[model samples]
Target chain A: MSFKVSEDVAVCGGRLLKLSHFSQVIGTIMNVNVYLPKQYYSQTDNKVIPAVYYLSGLTCSPQNASEKAFWPFQADKYGFAVVFPDTSPRGGDVPGDPEGSWDFGVGAGFYVNATQKPYDKHYQMYDYIHKELPTSLDEYFSNGSRLDFVDNVAITGHSMGGFGALAGFLKNYDANRYKSCSAFAPIVNPIKVPWGRKAFGGYLGADEEAWKGYDPSELVKKVSNRGNDRILIHQGTKDPFLESNLKPELLLEASKGTSWEGKIDLKLVDGFDHSYYFVSSFVPEHAAFHAKNLGLI
Target chain B: MSFKVSEDVAVCGGRLLKLSHFSQVIGTIMNVNVYLPKQYYSQTDNKVIPAVYYLSGLTCSPQNASEKAFWPFQADKYGFAVVFPDTSPRGGDVPGDPEGSWDFGVGAGFYVNATQKPYDKHYQMYDYIHKELPTSLDEYFSNGSRLDFVDNVAITGHSMGGFGALAGFLKNYDANRYKSCSAFAPIVNPIKVPWGRKAFGGYLGADEEAWKGYDPSELVKKVSNRGNDRILIHQGTKDPFLESNLKPELLLEASKGTSWEGKIDLKLVDGFDHSYYFVSSFVPEHAAFHAKNLGLI
Candidate 1:
């Protein structure tokens, strides 16, 4: 479970440490990029730095968000670190989309523990991201360090990863795992979407109940929002996938009359797309939100 | 002289309009990205917005800097439009590096008007960037528009384009074309380096006199610095090509006893490299500097 340092690049007022480590849950090597803010290096006092975990969308690696998201500057501003986890487990031996499509294969793991044949062995990204990777990172960096990668943390993502963030936040809402949650053009209701249907059908083996455990719309009704927590969401109107793949309105509809009613702050931005340009434009706002929740404000 | 609007992406508080037009000088289609600040769309009065032209380094298109430089936010912050010009004229018939190398080929035009065979036909980047592009863009957008792409503008670049900016700024010093000049890890004294030697020899023939016209070190002594103008430059200490290809000290040495002596602010930052990460880190400072020079402050 020891992490291996691959490349350390200096960005903004921080350093982006590209790391790879062995994952016991997936039984494969995983790549992750962590941006340690300037405070971590120029620490004069022992202050625990909170972390914001950013899960990327489909067909994205750690480098995509690390390079384009412009998160390092905000992390430096707020005295927090940003952790970018890879989208999917990748290798030559891994089974990809049968039709050689981009949406269902190597780059698109959908962040789920596959219970099906051929994919069950190595496609355990659900556990890898939520449970194992954070514990391993905490253990690796716990050498008299005060960087909290586990407890005092927040979660955010884009598109499918946005679905992951909402699902993870809702599933662990009872335990109060994540301090905050936000998403940019997220696939909120995945079970009813085409991309989610294929991924769920392939990974979870056609079980509707199994799919509910990973769907944010279903999780909202199961978990109670006691803190009156506000989950921020920004969906671009010009996003090409809004009508077909990401029906965010379903998520708001699902939370109706529940404990989480009126708690989801969904902001429909004007003239923006489903690209990183849209994600990065609102990153400062999300950073401020996360910083406030993480007690750095 | 007409521009074709290919892709208009909304980034930050502005619109990144990707345009392509036939260059009369280079005799080829060239791609350029223009980021019109929010002020342009929300104009309530006759406010003339200035432009900043950013040239890319070797093996770069307009997209590289457009995607990674994080200039849109700064452009919006300072109320300035940013023009990202292509490194060189590119096509299937256009000749590339003889060795099929990256640093001396199509992407590595070095922004010089070549006088050599084959390359001379399409390698008129110096004129295309400094003359044709600005004029065409100005004419194209002159329909009840307040965007100034010609007179009140600044120039900045990275690596080879750094040399281009310094050369262009100094060459047009008497005309007062650009209001400000800056570079990030630029090739200061290309005449004394291998990259410069190869490009000069191939494009300008073996005439050292012709090479001097395009060299920043040589231009500093020839052109007079009027208004106590300062050329801001940031060189990374950890940049792999600092000593060999980019001899920024040589430019300083050549500027000794000249009008530009003690005027070039060459800052050697620690532990940085020749990447967009390095450039984007210092863009805010450069943006503020240009804002002051362009009277935006």
Candidate 2:
């Protein structure tokens, strides 16, 4: 859990650290981006700050969401922490392809715990993100740095990341696992989509029953707690994939008739599409949402 | 001019155009980033909009000012145009740099009319940005697009680009040239600095008097326009180049002892450094400055 790429981002010399951590479940080292806020050093009484994990969509590495989205500004302002992990495991030791397209292989990690032979060895993104990443971040970044008033944990992501964030939050649901779970252009119900079919089948074998465990729709149906206090989703009306991969409607369906106290706010912003331009447009809102829920701002 | 980079940037479409012109003096082809208000297409034009051109420091193209600092969101609210031009001409068979360091070569096209050999042929950034870019934009972007509200214009830049913005406004001194001028960590008093010495010596030759024409301090000293304009500068106490390259004191000195008509607002943002992070922290303020001048919220 040593830092590799460190850049001086803000005053008080707050540093953004990118580290390579060996995920025990996946058996591969994953690169993660961490924004150590301005108060990290000043209040070094070992207080833990609230953290929001941002998962990237397809064809994106940890760098895409960090550099392109300008996440540090929001992270710095709200005085919370943000963690960016690579979308998927690479190298053929993991399953090579689910139909081998740009949308699936290499870049698309789908945030699932793989069950198939080749993939099961390395494609444990669910555990790597939900469990391993938290453990690593706790030991490495918070060392000697007070993070108090920052522990309103939240999970948020974009597109595939949105799905991943949902899974990460639901499966790890504790009394205070995540205060909020929000997504930008999230593919809410991945179990019924083409992307989900290929990725789930290739990584999790031919079992649709197992897929339900990772599916947001199924998770809400089976689990009653849903410790994430709220879920906010922003969907673009003009998103070409809105009707297909990013079916926000199914999540709406899943939430119905459940005693779960979590609220899902689905906002369809006009003229927005599935691009970084759209993500960046609403990124401030998303950051503020988590910040408010986390009690940072 | 067609839009190349227009998606939803903070509720508006940010447009960038590749402009080509038969400039009698400078290069024939250049690119500029244009941010149009969301209402530009939707609103019926009953009024005009004000715009500001931001110049970047050394070793950057027009895209640097746009990408490094998320200017489109700001431009959207300002309801004005933000044109960022390439610092200098390239791909023309001009003198190649013998030195490889970026400070002297292609990227560092100091916004000055070069008199030195090799550079003299095409190093006409001053004219390109000032005359050519404006002329082309006025012809193509302002008139052809729904940007009729571009009646007011302001200029702002960072580091060397800041010097260029001030020098351009003061040298031209148009009540119409720009309604305001501002900067973040600008290299003020370029004629009296080491960086200015090398760049001016190389481009404008060793004649200090000739170099003075390109210096903002000298230009501000001669300001005759006595009403309704002000200059704003935000300097960082921790900027590494504060002592040598950026002399905000020189600008203050030149503006002293005269009504000068134009006000100077020099601010020292505490603990900020000379990075995109620093600029980004206050980018909204600069954009709003132009917006208020543009008569839009």
Candidate 3:
């Protein structure tokens, strides 16, 4: 878990840090982009802002959300930390495309702790993100952030990462660990979708019962789903993956049309695609939505 | 040339056209993004506005400039047409990189009309951009555009495209082709620079004489240096390539210290890199710069 403060960019008084981490989880060194909003320092009396961890989709890294998705301005205004970790580790330790066709190899960390042979050595994203990664970030921003705020964390993501956030939270539901949660265009059930099936079959080795542990719909159904009293979900109406991979309705079905369904606020945005343009067009609102619920003001 | 008008995003009443072309010169089918400002309809009854073509650098397509670069507002103010052509052709008959790499194979046209081996069959960028490309664009804009305004074209690009714009204006030297020129962090002298040497040597063979035909420094030495007069070059002082590849001094030297010395208006931006962050920061000014010169305002 050792890292050097190699590069720093002055962004709205806070710093955008790029840290290189060699992990047993992802095997190779991972580059994570952490955004410490200006409020972390301006408060002066040492107040840690509530934090949000944003995970990108397959074929994406921490850099994708920070640079392309326009997350900082919203983070700066709302006063929160945004942690973006790479999808998968790079270099030799992690196995990549023997046949170099985009997706599935380097940038694709399916969020499941890998159980298959070769991948098991490196692919431990579930643990890396949910457990160890946050522990490290807790220290990284502590210099400028207050200890109270770090404890008040919210986890959310897009596509695969969205699915990851749900599974991660449901699996580790010690209400004390995280204060709230949400997702933008999440893959609700991986076992049911093509992308999820392929990734799950390859990584987890075809155990249907075991697969339920990683599926949000299944996880939500079994457990009484509790985090924030309200879970905000934003999905683009025109996303190509909407009808298939991201049937957010599944989460609704799993909530079993009960009180938990009332807890999930689903927003359908118009004329948006699966691309970053779609995410960026609505990132500002999502940040504010989380901030308001967290009472960050 | 039979492009089926796939997607059109209208900004300021001017349609950004995505056209398909079998670029015999570049040896593939190319996608070009053209922006027609509001003035195309507002200015004079049937008044056609002059145009400026913007070429992007490595790993980028025409869409990159138009989408996130924030060029629409500036284009509307200028009342001119801005064209963005794909860096290179893809999935066509063109024999591009049997082994793909980001630099030489695709998305990195270097804007040079290739001459070596497999590249020569389709990599005729010089002809495609300077000749075939504009002919159709002139026809598309129609009316006076097909007549006078379209002919009064200025060329500019960032990085590799900057080098392209310089070479296009120089070698072609069609008084009717490009009326003026400028660049954004362009690779000025390829022969003297590592990137240029690798690309030119591979594409044009070891012919220094032929390379000269493409080098801005060499081209400037032969032609009217101040032709870039009233031209503006916006570069970041912190640009990583400032010393190595984009030696503005080489361009400064090529003009015999006379042409663009100060008149060309070299702006050295502080605390910026060669990345889009730097480009996005100053793209508005560049649009305005060309718009003023093109008389679209």
**Which candidate achieves the best lDDT against the true structure?**
1
TM-score of chain B of 2: 0.88
TM-scores for chain A, candidates in order?
Answer: 0.98, 0.89, 0.91
Residue-wise lDDT of candidate 1 within B187-294, one digit each (tens)?
988889999999999999988898999999988888988858999999999999999999789989999999999999999998999998899899999999999999
Ranking by TM-score: 1, 2, 3
Question: In terms of DockQ, which candidate is strongest?
Answer: 1
lDDT of 2 at B152: 64
Give all candidate RMSDs, comma-separated: 0.9, 4.5, 6.5
Q: Per the 3 Å backbone cut-off, how many clashing residue pairs does candidate 1 have?
A: 0
Off by over 4 Å in 1: none
Name the candidate that leads on TM-score. Answer: 1
lDDT of 1 at B238: 90
Per-residue alpha-carbon lDDT of model 3 for B148-250, expressed as tens digits?
3347788888899888988887776645467677788988889999888878887899888888888977876676543445556777777888998898767
The positional error of residue A273 in candidate 3, measured at the CA in angstroms, is 3.6
Expressed as tens digits, the lDDT of each residue in B52-112 for candidate 2 is 7888887787666666677767766656767777666666675545666666647677788
Select the stronger candidate by DockQ from 1 and 3.
1
Which CAPRI level is candidate 2?
acceptable
lDDT of candidate 2 at residue B271, scale 0 to 100: 67
TM-score of 1: 0.99
